[model samples]
Target: MSPPAYSRVLLKLSGEALMGDQGYGVDPAVVTRIADEVAEIRDIGVQVAIVIGGGNIFRGMAGSARGMDRATADYMGMLATVMNGLALQDGLEHHGVPTRVLTAIEMRSVAEPFIRRRAIRHLEKGRVVVFAAGTGNPYFTTDTAAALRAMEVKADVILKATKVDGIYTADPKQDPSATRYDRITYLQVLEQGLKVMDATAISLCMDNKMPIVVLDLNERGNMRRAIMGEHVGSLVTV
Candidate 1:
């Protein structure tokens, strides 16, 4: 087979993706499926690093909306992310793929602290690095964390795995008239308020001239196809 299109990629997986068909928390079957997909990409010689969100366990914004302190809620959300990181690590390792769980909150007992150089080194050595805890700060989403980590690691692109196959003009599930965009501009996404990613994350990628590919994680082999540059989803570019 031909070499992969991208040597390195940062995969942004939302916590809800881990829930699968369940209402909340993780589904072991979903984790295993994701692990298998990740392993396939790694076996193809593509360096993979991931930043997982904690929406499945806890959402800081949701808490804040319920009158809780925003910062405190965000911290709790960060901890939830760590829990997800561990789960993903377990799944990946079970498939014989070496993985590391690094947290921004400095949990020395369970995971290593987030170190940029060390993370890159881990990827270089063929170990997938899972960045958890959402930048170790409040008021930032995991989307922003993904962008920041991708830039730090100099990843070629960010693969944002979502439930939908690609970004649509409207919510596809609710609006049958919605259409998917094969390619879109950062300015357009911002102006239209498309939910491809958060504004902060989009701005970060735009400023750095980094590209993002939004694809459906539930689709079998979609992640591999995206990594291979097969036009699997919508591409957001400058």
Candidate 2:
């Protein structure tokens, strides 16, 4: 087999993606399918680290909109991510993939605290590290955490797995004339107010000269193709 294009990659998955066709919560079959794909990439020699969102179980912003304290709601969302991380870890382990869950917040009983060196070590040993807790701070999105972790671990790229195939001129679901962008710049994303990721996350990647590939995770094999450096999604750069 050919060597993988990237030695290390950070995959950003939203919690909603784990819901499959369900309205809420994780769908076991969907988690297992994603785990299998991760295992496949690992077998091909790609060091994988993941940062997952908690919108499926709890969205902090939504809670705040409904009159909840912003910080409290955000903390609740962080805990929800821990739950998703554990579920993902279990799925990966079931496929015989070594995995670890590291959290920004101290959750000694459930997972290890986030230690940059420890996370890098885990990757070096071929253990998939799942990062949970949105930087242990309120108001920060998981997208920012993914970018930070990717830089700390020196990941070659970030694969943002979402429902859409790529970044578009407009929301394809809502706009019939929306067009996908094969490549785009971080500045262009921000100037246009495109929701490829939050401004903070995009800025971080831009300053660090890191590339992000946005692709549809619901499509089987798309993740693998992304890791293999195929043109399967929109490439975002400085």
Candidate 3:
């Protein structure tokens, strides 16, 4: 399917999603599969910028709840993202797709520093850029980081790859009668308190007028469909 009107996009993937059903850390096989999907999308002509979370390995909130300091836990979470980013970079390269990993926190040994101009230049040259580390700070979620990077890269849309297909009225796992939205407005999402993404992340998108497409990453080629602006999931736009 032809994409609606996206020249470039930022994909926000949760780390736990990369773990498949194992519940913690990345499953190499799963990460490869995700990379393959991304590679396929890239082949179709979408400049992709990705922000991967570290919840699969460690979540700052979970660690802090267990008596770990919030800032330290967040830093550890950032490190986890670096590991995941490295794995993704390898996976994409193995598929013959040129990939670059950039970190908000400087990690010269592993990836390049996060520079907006450099990232755009790479994308222009047909390279996929993976953004790691959560905004180089604590007390923030990767979702916020994704929003930041999306804006910096001048992404046309935010493609949120989640476990569920789209935003639903209720938790589909818990409520059999839950209904999914085909499309939605930012105001409605905010007023309804939907949980597709965090308030801060949503606000960033709304303020920037960047549409967010929430689709299931488990479905093969769903990311491509989302980029094409097919009715794949709920589109949160102004």
Q: Please list the Cα RMSD from the true structure of every candidate, rounded to 1 decimal place.
A: 0.6, 0.7, 1.3
The lDDT leader among the candidates is: 1
State the lDDT of candidate 1 residue by residue for 1-238, as single tens digits. 7778899999999999999889799999999999999999999999999999999999999999999999999999999999999999999999999999989999899999999999999999999999999899999999999999999999999999998899999999999999999999999999999998899999999999999999989899998988877999899998
lDDT of 2 by residue, 1-238 (tens): 6677899999999989899899899999999999999999999999999999999999999999999999999999999999999999999999999999999999899999999999999999999999999799998999999999999999999999998999999999999999999999999999999999999999999999999999989889998898887898899997
Write the candidate numbers in order of decreasing TM-score: 1, 2, 3
User: Per-prediction TM-score, please?
Assistant: 0.99, 0.98, 0.96
lDDT ranking from best to worst? Answer: 1, 2, 3
Candidate 1 residue 202 Cα shift, in angstroms, is 0.3
Supply candidate 2's per-residue lDDT for 210: 95
Q: Where does candidate 3 clash, by residue pair?
A: 3-228, 4-228
Model 1: pairs clashing at backbone N, Cα or C within 3 Å: none
RMSD of 1: 0.6
Distance from true position, residue 137, model 1, in Å? 0.7
